[model samples]
Target: MRFQLGWSLVWATLILAGCASSRPAATTSGRSAVDYNSYNEDLSSTRPVYNAPLTNVTPVTRSAAPSATAPAPTATRKNEIRKPNPPIEALHVNRELDLILDTIAIKNRTVRYAPGFRIQVYVGNQRQDADAVKLLIYQNFPELSPYLSYNQPTYRLKVGDFMRRIDAERYYASIRRLISSAQLQADKVDIRRSLLIK
Candidate 1:
């Protein structure tokens, strides 16, 4: 009975210690308690009130320190707003550079075909297999133009007239999901078709 009473006393002491807070009470020292009702009055008294008219106030102009040779710049009035000069319309070009650019553009325009990339979806002897793959690509990606051509015994199925290999790789990745045989190949791409497809 004595042992049980001692354990109960220890538990009671632990419970009391856990429940009791050690933090000190909040103190205001000498200042009075903050009154929320006089917020506007307190704010007004603390803020510096400006009596000057804002419309007449000119912005202080910052400039480089004046040299003896350079004349002092005239003071700008608040009302006298300076409009920015119109943007330069005419572009000055170097005659030699302009000629070379024009030549390159003309040459590119005249070229109907260029060595580029095409995503070959399938290449086999069976025409039906090629047609099936083409149909699959068409259904999944309507934007991609699939072409199936028979060359002698073998049939070829190619998709997308991509000028760059990077572009061809992008389409190949998506097509690979549907057709395992999809491959990126180098071919003469019609510039018009490539541009239109993109």
Candidate 2:
């Protein structure tokens, strides 16, 4: 009886002591249950969509592009022609160019500024015959200007202010052809304007 009483008292004391010192046990019914199955499966990220507000702008109502027809462009200045202008006569250069000008004027009929030569017509024939020859020469070529001289024993006929011996030789050949036996002598005589004119 004594042992049974001791064991009962010890059990009663343990029960009271646990009740006094510990918190109450929680209930599982009211709260949501955590899904343990989600821990194993793949789930996409959950982001918010379409947050931008309406812009409040007016819609543009464009009419047909300024009717397909327009007038041609006109030149502003009065002198300018509507169509392309004709090409100018010549293009003008900006600067003036210097040119050579002959300053000295020739005034007299037969004057010699420079010393030169003349050609003489040779005649060993009589004065009358030489005059006949001269007449024939003067008639044929009026361009040839001649001067006459007589030393009594000889009748000398001369023509031209020939600048070169070759010119005299040329004239001599022509004269010899006409006069049959005419000769040529190259001499340094004065150049005159009468030869140029005739």
Candidate 1, residue 64: Cα displacement in angstroms equals 16
- The per-prediction tally of clashing pairs is 0, 1
- What is each predicted model's overall lDDT from 0 to 1? 0.76, 0.58
Give candidate 2 regions above 4 Å deviation.
1-119, 188-190, 194-198
Residue-level lDDT of model 2, residues 1-198, one tens digit each, is 999999999999989987783544444775445555578643545655655432332333334653457433334345432433323432232121111112123334244544444445555548887787678778865666666788878887776556666776777677767776655555445555434632
Off by over 4 Å in 1: 1-100
Q: Deviation in angstroms for 10 in model 1?
A: 71
- In order of appearance, the predictions have TM-scores of 0.47, 0.37
Q: Candidate 1: lDDT of 54?
A: 34
Cα error, residue 2 of model 1, in Å, equals 77
lDDT of 1 at 164: 88
